[model samples]
Target chain A: MTELALAIENLSFAYGAKKALDDVSFDVRPGECTILLGPNGAGKSTLFSLITHLYDSRQGRIALCGFDIKKQSLKALARLGVVFQQTTLDPDLSVTQNLRYHAALHGIGRKAADNRIQEELERLNMFERRGEKVRQLNGGHRRRVEIARALLHRPSLLLLDEPTVGLDVPSRQAIVEHVHALVKEQNLAVLWATHLIDEIAADDSLVVLHRGQIKAKGKLDYVLQTTGANDAGEVFNKLTEGHKG
Target chain B: MRLLHYWRAMMGIVGRELLRFLHQRERFISALVRPLVWLFVFAAGFRAALGVAISPPYETYILYEVYITPGLIGMILLFNGMQSSLSMVYDREMGSMRMLMVCPLPRWFLLGSKLIAGTAVGVLQSYAFLGIAWAYDIQAPLMGYVWILPALVLVGMMLGALGLLLSSLIRQLENFAGVMNFVIFPLFFMSTALYPLWKIKESSEILHTLAHYNPFSQAVELIRFALYEQFNLDALIFTALSFFVFMSAAIFGYNPSKGMMVRKGGGAP
Candidate 1:
């Protein structure tokens, strides 16, 4: 009976007359990584926007650790960290400077922010690159900096929207392993949106979204069993069959 | 504790802005060069063409450069404001603005801090222009420099807020160039920045009325009076009121459900 790290109920969103997310409901629990599997046109990004309060919808309720996103946004958002699909770092600023700015936004003191910055950067093997401007970092190093920045405040829930989309195999593998370790060791809840089936771990929870609707939702094995799919890719194709994503 | 958090957030935003300003040496140079061109070249040419009647802020007959000094300061604020907003639109397009918007703070406070940060940079540019003008011998009363700080900050915030409002309305970065041509030019040319209201009135009644009421005109007069160690209540009130309206509209325009974000498909995802 632990409180859910993130809870969404009956969430719906539309752009003009076209629906983006239709009556979606889900929950993410602490210490688990929920892989939100969807294609390009699916409502994965829309759902992420709602949970992060980047967009508001009258059709649903979203709560973070028991606090409503709209009514108690400061409290709700304080418990959340995000690495958006786009690189949000100030390229002109050094890695440490970017992290410090984020930590200040969360109200972490200077000294404590520095300590956390070092710890997270070191965990991501980016401590040595702290003094370098973000523009100087390669794509992989920048992604690692972003991951480290997202964790500086130590939020219970981390929302990563396709964080590994353009990264190379090695960089992608490194980030995937690091995030899985975070879920296990820090009990951090993660709602990661991606179309890549390879990113789905065996123990991960799965939500298959296609054309703004949830087609399947459960543990990876359970979803594979229910869909009668041999693997994650087959599960995705089975759920989103005949639809142009 | 909450106050400390707010303070830290403000410092972070402002520090980042200053750092960015320092890194862009070209931006600093351009900000100064535009006003200096008007001072050294345009004012010298216009000094003979335009004769000043004793104005409230001018105790005696003054050279054209001295008369236009405050107007040029207004120029610096105006351009800096637009440039900052231009960067805002760019930031939105590039997704850095999304990072800022998602901060765990009240939306108004966050926007206000951005306005303050842009204003801080604008004020610095203004003072740098003033220092260069001092070297050029277009000096104001010593205390006028001190008095102008508050005036510059107020006017800078007002213009910066207008830029913020425009940034929210401008969905694409490409459309911003047109806005600059339309908004910045009309605001600059129609105001008292280049010519006196009376001089404008002599040419066209409608143009005169427009210049008389332009918020940029009031802003110029505000800085003009402060530079002479005087105060203009009318300009102060007008500029302050304009700031409130523009800032409120900007805050509304950034609202998730009600504003441009929802219309633009939740803005920069």
Candidate 2:
């Protein structure tokens, strides 16, 4: 059996008595990319928020690499990396400064931070622009910098919340292919969140969230075949349109 | 390694905050000019109506302008702190604050770095104002500055913490200006900056009592005491207490699941 990278069991959350995530549960395995597939208002953001410890779940627990999120947050968080749904960087600082600051936050020292920054910048093909301020970079390069910053600490589990939402086809595809290769090469567990169907890899596991509940989940081919659909989007629509197992 | 990390984080944060002020030159010029106007123009008229004397911190005869240096320093801190808090709200509105939350760093470290950066700007402005004071011959003893640096730092930190605490509570930037209006002016007018507490007492015992209880009075007094090279124990206690209170409130306001995060569950427009 694969090592469990993330385990969320009986998780429930609310906003002022309104349910955002209800009785949600799923596991993402090590060395694999698991896509969280959902439509709008399907509790994807809310679930992402809980996994990130942005909001504590009202019930159940989230374990990252077997570390409970609530009880051992820093240690658990230390082993995890994330690119938020929105960009969170100082526009005034140079690309190098932003990455360096992020490195320090993860307890990475100057020598290691510099070393890792160099390695990642080269990997992202962004070394030439290191000295440029963030506001000066175009959207695609800026997003690349964010991705590079997230990988600075070599986290075992990487969370990308709607990573390709606003990107053009080539840019989105680049991120999609890059993450796929990174997961296999590094033995990293990735929770890739997106509403777009085409981003889902046939080999990747899939979880379908609908209106705050997991309507379908498991192997991408199996789930798609069970719904008698050619693609995940059709399966998603069928699940939302009152079709039940 | 850890120290190096903090140093880098602090440097990054301070660099960003400073750059923000640099890009907005008009605002800084206006901020600096306001206090100078209060000194040269407003105080000029008020100086004749009052008797200036050698205070506890002053060694000999001094002009009214020289006497109010500490109070003016307090103004720098107070305004900077409020501006920092106001920007915190603005960052949330612009989605920048949300971005910072995802970094693997300790939340307090992030907050602390921002405070240090804001404090740094306050100190820089204080020094510039000090330079202007010297240029105009409103000079304190040259040695008076050694104490001034630490005083500016302490006062900046206290006010930065206050701003951070206020930022988390004041969810909307629209709500800030009105509250700050009520807060800043009263604190400045009631403090020992313009006149000694005793003078306010001579004018009205009730005003003296009000000023005595004002935490801002304590902050201004702390700076005043430091500027004169005499540490006031009461000022120290008051400053320490205010720091604790504001810091505690800030801690409460920023508690991830309980405070601002939960309050923002609906995701305001």
Q: Which candidate gets the maximum DockQ versus the true structure?
A: 1
Interface RMSD values for the candidates, listed in order?
1.5, 3.4
In the order shown, the candidates' DockQ scores are 0.72, 0.38
Candidate 2 clashes between residue pairs 3 or more apart in a chain or in different chains: A88-B99
Scored against the native two-chain complex, candidate 1 gets a DockQ of 0.72
Candidate 2 docking band: acceptable
lDDT of 2 by residue, A1-245 (tens): 66588999999888887888889899988788999888778888888777877666769899988888888776677777887667766787789988877776666777888999999989888998999999998777777898898899898888888877777888888888888988889988999888888998889999988888998888999998878888887987788884342
Measured against the true chain A, the candidates' chain A TM-scores are 0.98, 0.95
Per-candidate local distance difference test: 0.91, 0.80
Tell me the spans in candidate 1 whose CA falls farther than 4 Å from its real position: A242-245
Per-residue lDDT tens digits of candidate 1, residues A186-209?
Answer: 999999999998999999999999
lDDT of 1 at B202: 92
The TM-score between candidate 2 and the true structure equals 0.91
In the range B1-269, model 2's lDDT, one tens digit per residue, is 66775676667667668878887788677768878987898777787776667767677776777777778878988999988988888887766675556555567777888888888888888888888978988876677688777777877888888889878877778989888988888888988878888889899999999999887788888777777677888877878788778877786677666776577675421
